[model samples]
Target chain A: MKTKVYNKQAFIALQSILVKEITRYFRIWIQTLLPPAITMTLYFVIFGQLIGSRVGLMEGVSYMEYITPGIIMMSVITNSYSNVASSFYSAKFQRNVEELLVAPVPTLFILLGYVFGGVSRGMITGVIVTLVASQFVELQINNWAIVCFVVILTSMMFATAGLVNAVFAKSFDDISIIPTFVLTPLTYLGGVFYSIKMLPEFWQNVSLANPVLYMVNAFRYGFLGVSDIPIENAIALIIFFIVGLFSIAYYLLAKGIGIRS
Target chain B: MKNKAIAISDLKKTYSNGFEALKGISFEVAEGDFIALLGPNGAGKSTTIGVICSLVNKTAGSVSVFGHSIDQHLEAAKRCIGLVPQEFNFSQFETCQQIVVNQAGYYGVPRHIALERAEVVLKQLDLWDKKDSQARMLSGGMKRRLMIARALMHEPKILILDEPTAGVDIEIRRTMWTFLRELNEQGTTIVLTTHYLEEAEQLCRNIAIIDHGTIVENTSMKDLLSRLDIETFILDVDSVPNELPKLENVEYRIRDESTIEIDVPKEKALNQVFESLTEKGIRVLSMRNKSNRLEELFVQLTERAQVVDREQKNEN
Candidate 1:
């Protein structure tokens, strides 16, 4: 009976955190949801329509179709990462994270609450970007299960990474530095617009070292049934990252890093 | 004997910067007791509160709430405590109702129950009309009341408020006192820290004075006030006497044409002062304590503690 009551309370705490996070982004829709849709639409219009006409049939499919999954995955990664990082950091700046810190709620619940909130935003943005992509080209799903699993897992991994970043962040500038210097460069080089197979031998090996590359290839494989890396390898790597990042994020929270005195 | 609501044993905290905020202070609060944990600035009152709430890591020693050790049973211990921190810590963008309800949720209250509790607390704090307004839009006093409301939503057994009325106006502070008094009367254990010595004296049955990172005095309010050797009283007179009346063991100073301050020792009766004033033909219109009784003892105890600390330092 005691464990049951504890579980029930834990569930409510998780729900509260998740609802607050979702309401925050939805309350400022123009900033959180709209920007990603507009940016992805621009990518679809320029890279898939204007530039694709000149370079076609690189992956045995239309250029617009090949880049669709990558564009959608890109939205998921960036949105997931930014959603948790900005929300958690703002909570710290406002000194409101003490709400959870002082509560009876388990640390795991708090960590999962923020992670799932980020995943929710990421998945929602992914859907919005997909809808925009459909306006420019028709999307075909080669495997629905794989597509769902990869996108959700990739979002969870990035969200947990965002949490770790928020844990260490001391100022607004600290939160932005990681997204600008690390996320942006890695996303651009992660084969969002072109295939890694098109690169030289040495560069292909180096591209393999980028974690985002595996996420993009796995998502693309789910949609187009083609990938530079094996489907098994991509799924394994994504799971590996989710576990690793989740552990780090949980450890930081339990230790009260940057949040507690 | 009343059960202990909180037991902190040899609690110590040293910040990462090598500053020792708590130097093994030990104290216990009984169930249903309204106690004041008084301390000067940086005297470890806030750090001690932080450690009990698990917001600050204690370097050594132990804290237990309602028999649950903080280290071994943190969640169980936390469930008993509702903390209204010294600062406004809620999100500025969140509505008053949302803030209160969410705090309940964090403590595992169901949404419907939390919503109902939010209404009750908001109304109790006189924040019902501003329930939908964002937190930042509230005035300083209203924000503090909102924090109190939020802390009370879960109905915890122990409510710990750190400087809950630091900058509040007297009227609002009195109203809050009434509310907190009602809470204590209903059997809730309240541990409060406030710089307002009068507030502490009025509301708390017990008092603990900390200074130089140590517990210098811990006694009941009645007993502690009895330790005051002398009390200064300000008297308003109809006219000043040309020659002040001299009394045994009493000193007097004229402030203005119609006012005089008198230091009355514990053995002297106030009626004796009144009789002497009548004999002197100095018509006393009003009289009040020049400083709060607790304030006087607090200063004496803290000052003595400082002297002891200096002596130890010299010895070292």
Candidate 2:
């Protein structure tokens, strides 16, 4: 049996790919990162500061603080998701991806490279939104570890989701469809503004089915020490979702599902 | 001398849609060997390269490089190979140096070493001056050279080029050919796939002609040429020939009443024909031999597949 030595090259490949992904969006930072920050800022101003004043407290916390973490998580998820999805799809569209595909790097590393790139951008945008939200909601972190962990996990989840989308996407419109039709709706109704406690019993069960509800409330709990579901359960659910997403992503990549060949 | 840098045996690929892209390809390329994969479109040329590069999955087969099995040692096999693709398929937003160096990193070279190799390859390919320019800003020829430089940065033992100079300008094509020949002399086993038969004739020592997803012919260039059996020699006499050259194993046609077109079995003694013309006190003119090379072989193989297709359709 022959043994292969340690592959330091995989890490370098990962870093370079991450840089390429980062610069791709940063090169057009005004369009890619800045617009989202500005848009999220407006949401905080209009919905949280301006609108929350009239609505008052839901779940006993100020509307401004309740929506802050959810909004930050949302931006992180979407940005990370969109970054990898569009970048990978663009590589496919331009036929440039053949270079990497033809290289000897492990498929897992390639996936990580693109995912980290998206995740990095997502985190950067999320931090920016969080800072802006701090001014409006007077944010607090009940558990710094949970806040950071959820942010990173959510970034990974969405990054993998984005790549899967890119692989299945045949054209430009294919990527945006899920984001517009599916992602936006689930998010808007995922307890971003109001808690599930306000809902009747039947509707409350239905809301529990939305995974984003767990993620948002879990993230919100990290900030204000309150959540719709148990904090410990939310952590378990996020980890469960991460492993499930990671396995599916790995299997899809290894099988070259929509991509291999 | 190096025990066959690349040894491929019984490689096959069947698409999910039931199309057999490759029907058990088998070949061996020695160190410093320049082999040309010649065929028309969809003849499994790309599929063969894809399998060796580990991009295209094979339905059934085996391949080895540097005595290492591909399945068990993909990274090791890949580390020994470099692929230069046909299309200008790179991150266009990055500069030329970035593309080459980034590719080197994928192979696990340290950053400084990768940079040094990048500089050397770029200079060799006449791309040093354009190092700062992004791929989108460069001309088609420069972009092709950039791709070549990127592939060379890692210094792999086997270099596979898929139509590296397909649509470039004449000057650039000639430059690329010269650079490749230099690399070949330095002991890199080059596997080139191209539409240009003349390139194969000029560069490759061994040739494989594939058609309809199967290997039609594989042999030394000398053997393939010899087997062709026909050569047209153009002899320009100082004066118009009143009659054609009366010689055995040859045919002639008067051209402008000065040049005579001579067709003969390449093995026939052309010296006898020459002596007869000299004995006739005919002033010798310039002569040109039209050896039927890979061009004829490629045309024959591609056309034969087409005929087969036609017959199959007719029977159906």
Candidate 3:
């Protein structure tokens, strides 16, 4: 019969969900945190050591250094997307999502709790990939603020996107389809390997349409002080996507779209 | 004036598939009252609970808890409710203690308080020893108790249990009944939907029988039972009468050599039948109601609803 103030209740609820999510993946660190590290290590070994030795500089830097930001960005995007999509979908599938739905927590806090959890995983994986990259290439951060902003925003953007995916997802298979068909292609073609300028005019325009391109290039600018696009434009697009996706997520949650029915 | 723990009016639910699961139903539960919301499967009991808890969108209706409207004061309304859903809805991998504590945290209980409440409820539910075990590892009965323990963590004023004892063994079910009685005695308003009529008859002071998305009867247990026109009793006899006893306003049949079934209408007196049998030198050893009184009323009401439904369909 005791009721806390609204803000306090929301804070506690959000913290609980975040803690639950963190504990879940942390308990299975071998599966959640370890795989990305090993995968990024392989990427550094093959792309940075073996392939960069054969290929010359493309973006005014060695192929290894040029792809480092893209690789790290790739891991962050995938980790953020997969973390929310899989985790939320699992909650739905297992029906434990009802716990939050029945509680006094607002929909906004519930959405944020899941997103922050994804962001945490994304940040952790990004750091792991960075460490793995530093083993092969000399690393230097050009703009600390931009780097932090880009990585966090990029993670939030994808985590929000993952939440949207999870809201519409009907099954476990639905959760994976977007990451595989849509996300993988977008990340790879987002110019993780080669500069978009090297492509033909029509392909360059197509690459420009890929939002991941802006994120990767912006992140590249943060690390190497070089980018294929303007930093301001990249930041603008990231903000735009985050706002758009978050609005959609909030609306879906408010409507009780998938989680409620 | 005493406050109502829950007040629902004109509740209706139309699924996305156009199934009108709940027509329009209105009911209220008084504070500190233990009530049974009895209905067959698909009778809208779960949907009603779902709407109160905001798990399902209501197509039309209003539900308020302790005078807090769900729409205008959702958090306040939700703060007063604890829902134990019919299914095992907790994360299977979570430890028993973690499940309860996390649920408390969702209600804004601090980590320390949540942890303390978790231990207390888990121990009270006899799940403390299994606090560290994964939820999936517990037996079905223990899992059910875990749900109760989780729901009780925040200690809401009103607890709605949706078939909490389904699939549980009789012994555990009775123990849960006792626990719930204790909780209700301490002033927790309990509204339980149960398929077991005996549990309802034994535990709840009030009853509501819902049929075909409508409430056919909502009254105190005494009033509901008083509405029964006839009750059958099974009597153990020391000696079998070759001919069944003849009594006015009563039907009699022999079940076997030692047992007899007697259908007693409200107009008939039990002592009259005993006196008539005693004059004939037949002594009754024992007697028991052939069925729980609530079960008999529930069947009659539901069947009557079906008949009315069929008649309406034919007219249409």
Candidate 4:
């Protein structure tokens, strides 16, 4: 069929995917975004108000503000990670990914599709929870650009990571195991509720091994202009992981790792 | 490269598990060719399409689409080949039009051009009415048509369909086939993998039968049927007389508990048999060739192959 052509349809397709991704989480907001906000509120009540009364604060900021950045970062981390993981996994499960895979779409655009899907959900939940945290404590957004940068970049990073997870994952259990056995513990001990300075010198040194620590502290710096870890390293490492994860995702997809077979 | 729209040269695929799926398969589909890739399940049909589309990485051999080596110029090669996978695989959340337009984008068609192509392709496939419908909301046959529409969005030179009408009803399938033939007439080389041999017999001018991960037979349709030399015919009469009548080049066998199989050779005419039957006034029952020769030939070859395989297994 010598059909008439619409040059702007690429924008339409991208718009369609973004709309679909947004709608997917919105339709299931009860499960995707709302729960994390609730979980963080609980953390605010128990960990910040109750635990801070006894543990005190660090870096001259109240424990509430200090932990707020980490909690918000944690939300971005989990939401982005799980959104891509489950969404892509579901596509694999339902055989829908095959549709896009066979198309002439570039590997990057396809990766961007699923990765940005995770970004949208992560940021949506991150913002909502940030609002919720404001009801409890005095908040400061020292650098809005950095705050948005880290949120979006971290979201992109974890979303790509989640896409890789979806590629290798075989079943539903495979999808959940990472969040439980790997992500949850990493986020919690990642200094989400306490400063690394609270840890003994040896443990504090060991805490550097956690990638989430850098992300959380970097995000905290974005909020209050302070960080236990070097902010430059935080920014560089995020870019590093984003590039790294995006490449791995591109490889797996181009290789048709799980979907084609 | 020589007016060949699609050429698969010694294509082989061996999985990481060491199970060979395509054992050096070789064939060429000329421009505007309608070739049927015929096989039973687990016979490497999907593998062939997957390899051509660059979805299933090949362990050996090479494939070229419209003279561009997929290995050397993947994007250019892939741009010429559009594959409609057998399974329902589009994102359920996407409307039918979105799926088709997105596929166009992969080929570097801009969004405006993609939508225009998407609209025409969708309408041609009888899916324009369902353009805005979510893929999951459509019926099975409509979804299958949607897939075909999506594949055509880029106006690919070579279109590969994996069982394009496997689950659809006969009427709808026929409708799809008609549209496909029109598309094929417009100079798109169509490669189809199908289980329905009768459909293969009707639509494909050339046929390739794959068995046990190998191209067992590949030939033009006329040549393939002429190769089916076992001739069959039917005699119609009131009933068979107790006394039997012998006719040249005709072999008989009882069928349906009362009917009989009559096989005739090329040298003999039905009139001779009719005269012989009338000479005895033997009441004959209704008769016709059991079916086209391909079915019997396919059965004969595969059965013989299986028997040989079994004997070899026993010896091993």
Candidate 5:
């Protein structure tokens, strides 16, 4: 009975944090939900339609179809990463994160609450972008299970990574530095616009070192039934990152880094 | 032996920069006791509260809430405390109602129950009318009350408030005092730290004064005040006297033709001073304490502690 009550309270605490996070982003839909949809639509028009026609038949499918999954994955990654980073950092900046810190809620629950909130935004944005992509190109699902698993895992991975960024962030400038300098560069260099098979052997090997490459390729394999790298290898690498980042984020919270004195 | 609501022993906190906020301070607050943890600025009052709330890590110490050690039963210890920090810590963008309800949710209160409790607390705090307004839009007093309302939503066993009425108007401060008094009457233990010594003197049954990162005095309010050897009163006279009246065991100073400052010992009575003034043809129109009685004692005690500290440093 005691454990049951504890679990129920923990669940309630998690729900509260998640609801606050969701409400915050939705409250400013123009800033959060709308921008990604508009950005992805622009990507579809420019890269998928205008540019794909000139550079076609790179993969077995049309260029439009080949990049659709990668585009969706990109939206998921960016939105998930930014959502937790900005929201958590804002909470810290405002000093309101003390609400959770002073509560009886477990640190793990707080961590999961923020992560799930990010995942919710990421998944929502991913679906919106996917819908926009469908208007421009017909999307085929070769493996529904893999697509679901990859998207969820990838969203979780980036969301946890966003929390780590928030834990170490001392200023608003610190929050944006990672996304601009590291995340944006890595996402573009990942297999989003082109497959690694088109690259030289040395360049391909170096590209393989990028974790985003595995996530994008795995997501693409789910939709196109073809990938430059093995699907199992991509899945393994994504899982490895999720565990490592989750542990690091949880440790930061437990140690009260950046938030507590 | 009353049950201990909070027991902190040898609580020491040395910040990374080597500033010692708390230096082996130990104290206990009995259950249902309204205690004032008094201190000047940077006297470790907030730091001690921070450690109890688990908001700041202590370098070395043990804190327990109702027998639950913070190191072992952290969640249990946290569940027992509701803290109203000195600063406005609620999100400025959220509505008052949301802030209160969300705080309740953090303590595992169901949404429905939290809504009901929020209504009760917000209204009790006179913030029901402003519940829908964003927190930033509320007046300073209302914001402070909102934080109090949020802290009370969980119905914590002990409510610790740090300077809850710093900049509040007298009317609002009075109402808050009444509200807090009623809260204490209902068996809720309260620990308050305030620069308003009058507020502390009026609201708290016990007093603990800290200075230089250490507890200097810990005693009941009545006992501490009883230890005051002298009380200074400012007397307003109807007419000026060329020479001040000389009375035994009473020191008098002429501030101006119409006012005189007198220091009366505890054993002396005001009637004796009045009779002497009457004999001297000085009509006393009004009299008031030169300062808050508690404030005078607080200053004296802290200054004494500082002198001791300086002496020890010299010896070292």
Candidate 6:
């Protein structure tokens, strides 16, 4: 169906866009790749060793192991969202989005190219964070499919959201606003360090409202076979959000909301 | 009928802030035509080019490239066009080779083909030695050439250059003109927008001049140039004439003892002036136009458009 929608030119155009996006961050790995690895390392040390030890067992597993999936998911979400948000905003700022707009590339391919760039960064950083976590915790992989599915889907979801943020963003400060005020708080409160069961009933209901909770818990379920919500429900939520966010991103692009004018 | 390289019918664009940049403009470029789209600043030249490339959304009307409607067959329409925008839109961090190769890839050129094409175009543009250098490291003239190189990599049927030599040095500008002339000779349809009337005069066969978001003139270059009523020419004489001889319907002003400027009407004959000058024993050494004809015409049209604007405002 994708091929039917896009001819050979569009396909090649997509590849070119993807290659450019990939090379951009890779060329500056110290800025894009290294920062997250170092930050996640500090998180593992400070939260898992210093504070997580006193916090003790969560769901009958060691605190470090219980929070491992959540921390990794956090990095994936942040990196995926930030990569696209910053990259796309910078393109808009420099007016080079015109290059993509003027090309024969389909709108879907353009969106996919940028989203995949975010996904690539998210997955790479996710892997590095996972490796960092493995050093401190006896990690177990209960369902690899669910792990891969959840990881990819979460990255896609956040990447799409970041694109939407970029479409509406007018300045560099605007790009950072959502990630700081909304993303950071939602991610931290998404049951990363502790399970929602530790919260009172009212707060647990509040935590359930956060979409990121579904992603982190789904990822945690893949690794430990334990989850607050049904695995099927978490999986469905992730898919639903991915579809919804992708549609929104496509609509914004088609309408030429911010970039075209 | 021959295929049109570009066709725009009633194209319109109004920004979200209520700025009407293009107000229902329409024109066409035939295949292989080197046409100049000339206008003063803010006369919607860039907006028109932007709409053709899909960089700006059109509020109404339609555009087609080689029979492919931009609205329905945008990809096909875009495949036929290579646009060099007025600004440096490529990433400053990208190398010249990367920028050009990446542009070729956008048009569906394979990686190897894009690489070869990049080398060829860069070399042709005298930019091969700086291929690996970042774009920001290049001089302004080199940056402008780099944009042209990138645009030509895919070899689109139509190339739209918006002020390709705005701030370039005269030498580089002449080199670019020569290069563009050769490209035009190879049957590439070029539609350029520039403030330099001399560029339009030198390189274009047809021209469409816009003023206040409307086309005031669109015709063949020869037809446009023929519309001038009088042309001023400076004559260098071999002898210093104490008194200048004037012919009927010809106005002459002596610049120096041996140099004189004369305004020759379109209906006047040059031989009459030569006869009169020869009678005075003032032998002519050389003669040339006192100013660029196109520049004079452009100033007249823009000034006339401003008068109309003033009258409309007064009526309002």
- List TM-score per model, in order: 0.97, 0.91, 0.96, 0.90, 0.98, 0.93
lDDT of 2 by residue, B241-270 (tens): 565557777877777767778787877887
Q: State each model's CA lDDT, in order.
A: 0.93, 0.84, 0.92, 0.83, 0.94, 0.91
Identify the runs in model 6 with alpha carbons over 4 angstroms from their true place.
A1-4, B234-247, B252-261, B267-288
DockQ ranking, best first = 5, 1, 3, 6, 2, 4
Q: Write the per-residue lDDT of candidate 3 for residues B92-148, one digit (tens) a residue.
A: 999999999999999999999998888889999999999999999999999999999
Candidate 2 chain B lowest-lDDT run of ten: B289-298
User: Candidate 2, clashing residue pairs?
Assistant: none
Alpha-carbon deviation at B14 in model 5, angstroms: 1.0
For each candidate, report its DockQ versus the true two-chain complex: 0.87, 0.61, 0.83, 0.40, 0.88, 0.72
Superposed by TM-score, candidate 1 places the C-alpha of residue B68 at a distance from the truth, in angstroms, of: 0.6
True contacts kept of each: 0.87, 0.69, 0.93, 0.43, 0.89, 0.89
List of clashing residue pairs for candidate 3: none
Rank order (by lDDT, best first): 5, 1, 3, 6, 2, 4
Candidate 2: list runs displaced more than 4 Å: A1-6, B233-247, B253-262, B267-292, B301-316
Evaluated against the true structure, the overall lDDT of model 5 is 0.94
Q: What is the lDDT of residue B167 in candidate 1?
A: 91
lDDT (Cα, 0-100) at A128 in candidate 2: 90
RMSD per candidate (Å) reads: 1.9, 3.2, 2.7, 4.4, 1.8, 2.6
User: Which ranges of candidate 5 are over 4 A from the true structure?
Assistant: A1-6
Best-fitting candidate, scored by DockQ = 5
Cα deviation at B2, candidate 2, in Å, is 4.8
User: Could you give the CAPRI-style class of model 5?
Assistant: high
What would the per-residue lDDT of candidate 4 be over residues A54-115, giving only the tens digit for each residue? Answer: 76666888888789999988988999999999988998898867666665555667788888
